[model samples]
Target: MATDDLVVPEAAGAQYRETMPSFAQERFWFLDGLVPGNAAHTLQQSYTIVGPLDVTALADALTAVVRRHDVLRSRYVPAEDEVRVQVDAPRPVDLPVLDLSTEP
Candidate 1:
């Protein structure tokens, strides 16, 4: 989930509420090894950072990062509704960009 900002309130039970700095968060999920005749196990990773960012630059950087890392380009095939990892092409993908910015 990508959001412009995330505010966490301090002193929830107290009469006064203070809003702290917002953060940008990124989430990733990975599934590996099926259970004996069952579904595969999954691994999830999430990251949060606090600051202003250029979305386009960030996306480009993320693409470069993914390209640099072999895992992101890996593919998976479905087996009985469960996905199994497969070796895939290392080529970078041209993902469609969502226009979050309005024209000047």
Candidate 2:
């Protein structure tokens, strides 16, 4: 068998409109179906900011990060046969700011 003889059915240009989900994603989809509204698989981080903090700048930075990463704005579609990951176009993200500095 030659390398040129091999062909991929899903191959379509440099960008992919939709692709099959990875193993991890498939597992997550199954888990989600088993138990909806479960946050066990979610990852979160917290940080304490000291002194003068620019909330607007922070929100802007976070939104920029979300826009840069396609996975951040992706949607997983589970079909009867398989699961697919669809990446949406880059768009501005809504970042809410909280003023917890006034707390005692």
The top-ranked prediction according to TM-score is: 2
lDDT of each: 0.44, 0.71
Model 1: which ten-residue window has the lowest total lDDT?
20-29
For model 2, residues 1-104, the per-residue Cα lDDT tens digits are: 55234322445553434656667878998889889989998999998777898767877887889888867877888777677787665555676777776799
- In candidate 1, how many clashes are counted? 0
Candidate 2 clashing pairs? none
Residue ranges of candidate 1 with Cα displaced over 4 Å: 1-41, 47-51, 77-104
Runs of candidate 2 with Cα error greater than 4 angstroms are 1-17, 100-103
TM-score for all predictions? Answer: 0.34, 0.63
